[model samples]
Target: MAKTKNPTLYLTELDVTRLEGIASRAGTAELDEMLDALLERAAIVTPDQIPKDVITMNSRVICALEGDAEPREWTLAYPDDADLAAGKLSVLSPIGQALLGARAGKTVDYRLPNGTAQRVTIVEIVFQPEASGQFTL
Candidate 1:
């Protein structure tokens, strides 16, 4: 295995269980590849590390279509449920993976279906529910 900075998986309990369900439904190898890649790249950002308004894990992500108006907001989920929702997407998905731990008003580059690349700016982030009261990083 290649060396990486953050090795521990940082998924929520719900995420873990959801991934298990996906593995059962679709098999482990596929999901394993995604998990491996995510773990290798994820920075494991704490609340303090995140910027003032960034959208992060468990935040609602609003995505604007490239050409059309009317941005769509989605409740980011893990594994396949996210895989199914239109605006909501799997953290393993290209854009979702990029948006993880990102704060609001930040822009990120990610690949699209046609092999084209695009930059997206974060407009809003509704923080994780647990982050409301506990202000510790």
Candidate 2:
């Protein structure tokens, strides 16, 4: 993690449960570290109790990368559902980790493959599963 202050994270209970299993089962050090950090900092809430402004699993959001004119659209997903062509981003991915639990207007930072930090602003949430009353399990 960078020295930047981490923003408050709000994760649905269901998302936390599934991601906890993934963190334990995956057994990758990087994933474990990131997941642990995120989980530890997150405020777990019920599906219906989650705020509409927070990004939960399967949320479709528009992010504006620093210095980029074009904003990108992404749907946060689990690894199996990640499809770049379909704009589905994996929660385990660097960017996805930052996107998860972030609120609208918050800026998230992630490191690129080359170890350079990149920033993206959570400009708008086009859709969120919880907000739409789509509670999966």
Candidate number with greatest TM-score: 2
lDDT score of model 2? 0.87
Taking all chains together, the TM-score of candidate 1 against the true structure is 0.58
Clashing residue pair totals per candidate (backbone < 3 A): 5, 0
lDDT of 2 at 24: 82
Model 2 ranges off by over 4 Å: 1-7
Q: Write the per-residue lDDT of candidate 2 for residues 91-121, one digit (tens) a residue.
A: 8888998899999999989987689899999
Model 1, range 1-137, lDDT digits (tens) per residue? 22336532233333344545666677668667865566565444444443445444566766664554776676666654564446567766777766765556667777876988876666666555335633321
Which 10 consecutive positions of candidate 2 have the poorest summed lDDT? 1-10
Global CA lDDT of candidate 1, please?
0.57
Per-candidate local distance difference test: 0.57, 0.87
Question: At residue 18, what lDDT does model 1 achieve?
Answer: 51
